[model samples]
Target: MTRYEPAVDLNAITALDVHVHVESDDHGHFALDEELLDASAAYFKGSENRTPSVQDLARRYRDAGMAAVVFTVDATTATGHPAISSEEIAQAAAEHADVLIPFGSVDPHQGAAAVQRARHLVQEYGVRGFKFHPSLQAFSPDDPAFQPLWAALEELGVPALFHTGQNGIGAGLPGGRGIKLRYSNPLLLDDVAADFPGLTVILAHPSVPWQAEAISMATHKANVYIDLSGWRPKYFPPELVRAAGGLLRRKVLFGSDYPLIAPERWLADFDDLGIDTAHRPGILKQNAAHVLGLR
Candidate 1:
């Protein structure tokens, strides 16, 4: 099978958004359940549209002079809701290759089949990375059972992104819809980083209550990175801001958890932070380019 490479003309784009989501597939099925969706929409107060199609996102980013890495989470085994087709997302990304890069997701609970599907997504769909939600998927990243899944992605030379810290997926609900905060602990990924030396792990968001851990992981492991997303920048933990301006400058990538958190809002708040203007380009795009092999 031919691995799909996106057809984007690098010269035309100004930024590479690393953490956008394909909440709805081409078939019009949502990636999350109704109640949880409503709660998150209300929590984030998203105004730019809660759910977007791959084509819709491609057009939006292309017109905005940006490129986006897009994907849907597959939590079928955990949530009982079937996952959107990663292959379909890949096919659509190919159509709008100039602005879209596809990422793939599989419920880790499926064990070996999950690992197999991940391989298929990379080999057949041209996914450059994978997404995992520990809390929402009811799994821990350090669990020995998931080592194979991580190993397979490691072998493929594609990065694996894990949702860390506070989650809006089950936020504000009683018991957060049974999503446990412990599952998203950044410390768990430290173990994965140490165990899988070659695997590039992205710690998504600030990791909220575990911000310190996220900082330590990025500082300790050359392969671990942090994507500044999921929260408005003005509210970013002070340590994260310090790292962005200093030691973790090149390791932090700009990512707006778009549709939930708008890029305009995130960028505006980020500008107010007084980070060195010289490093802005890397945070905004170049760093992500290094991660994506786009440069």
Candidate 2:
């Protein structure tokens, strides 16, 4: 088994996409159930193949002259569906190290086993970070029971990216398939960030319905950051665009939430946002380089 190592030269890539999803494995396993997956596809109204493997991701990003942080959400306990193997994803990413960076996901409901798997993913597979979808995973991030997981990631010295705001998963389904939206509130993560100051906590996507709370946390906490994904740039809230240009420039990252939102489409919309050119570089790549220790 190959331990992951990043071979990509930061200078060679035009931008870094920190939020691409590896929705399927080579063996035809999907990260989410068919019903939820179909609902999300409809919500995003994206026509591209939604379930791309790691190799497909590498080719797409490489062709785009970009590097992508690829991961799958493991909500096995919550969804009762087997997750795509993160280890395999990381191993595959090793083959295309120049374009793909892997992140691992563990179901928070797994308790101590989850903590152990998280360490294994980092040490054995060389994952750069961990991904959690609080809404889909059906767990509250600030729960004391999961403190060990947060502490483990802090000691591991890798970032924990939590999906904040509205989730496309389970959208349009009756009762949203019992997925509790409250768990994804960015405020829930304020506790995690505060308790684990050493942990780099990434708030993925624009935390809609609580946009101000998300911006405030990133501004208030040095370790907190925001990845702009899930929504197209043209639809970004005015305050988010404002903060991304000014106070939060260094803490914001570029992410496409690919398959749902393509990087090409995201970049095209971002170009028209009129953010200051000086801050563009940092948001597009430099800040991610620092966060990922790629520099």
Candidate 3:
């Protein structure tokens, strides 16, 4: 059980991708079932390899001159699919510490066990943060039952990255495979940010249909941030584009939701967003550095 630690040189890296996923382990086990994986692949129309290992991610990110925060979702209770071990991911990432930063995930439905696992991941495995998929996990972020989990993350002083808005997983399937989209609404995280002010909350993706709410929450809460993942920048809502260039410049971070949306494609589209040139550096790297405590 090797502990992972980041050795990324902020000056040398062009970007920090804060939302990449480790879809498969070395043994060829996938994080999601075939149905959900197929659904997401169809939705994104992605051509890149979908189930890349930790080593694959490391090679890709290193070749691209970028650093990535990699993780796998632990939706065991909701999806009934076993998750790739975050511990193994962390240990593998330790070998490529220059490019890969591991983030741990735990099934929120596991109650106290989840909280203990989170601490173990951080303290023992050296995970820098955690990833949560409310829609896939089928839990309301504001539910009181998960407060202890949030409190534990806050106590650890690491950020909580939650999937917000529409999810590609289970998309186009009958009843969307019973994954509730309502659970991912960024507004639900408002209660969490308000309650756990010390824990940094990263609302992943654009939060379409609720972009305004996401922007409002990030604007209203000092600890709240938004990651520009899961959507091409050209498709970003006008208000979000404006906010990223102006008031929310320091509150937005770059993320490509890799494997589904390639960083190269995301960056190409981003160039067309007309963001202020002065804000580009901060949006691409500086803001994420601060949010991840790398600064």
Candidate 3: tens digits of C-alpha lDDT, residues 1-295? 7898778899989999999989999888999999888999999997489999999999999999999999999999998899999999999999999999899999999999999999999999999999999999999999999999999999999999999999899899999999999999999999999999999999999998899999999999999999999998988999999999899999999999999999999999999988888889999989998988785
Q: Which residue pairs collide in model 1, if any?
A: none
Counted clashes in each candidate structure: 0, 0, 0
Q: Could you tell which candidate, 1 or 3, scores higher by lDDT? A: 3
**What is candidate 3's CA lDDT for residue 188?**
96
State the lDDT at 32 in candidate 1. Answer: 92
Q: Which ten-residue region of model 2 has the weakest summed lDDT?
A: 44-53
Q: Which window of 10 residues has the lowest lDDT sum in candidate 3?
A: 286-295
Give stretches of model 3 more than 4 Å off. Answer: none
List TM-score per model, in order: 0.97, 0.99, 0.99
Tens-digit lDDT string for candidate 1 (1-295): 3356877666788778899988898677998989988998888986578889898898889888988889888888778888888888888888888889999988899898989989988887889999999988899999999999989998999999999999988778898888898999999999899999889999999999999999999999999999998999999999999999999999999899887987778889999999999999999888888888885
Q: Between prediction 1 and prediction 3, which has the larger TM-score?
A: 3
Residue-level error in angstroms, candidate 1, position 244: 0.6
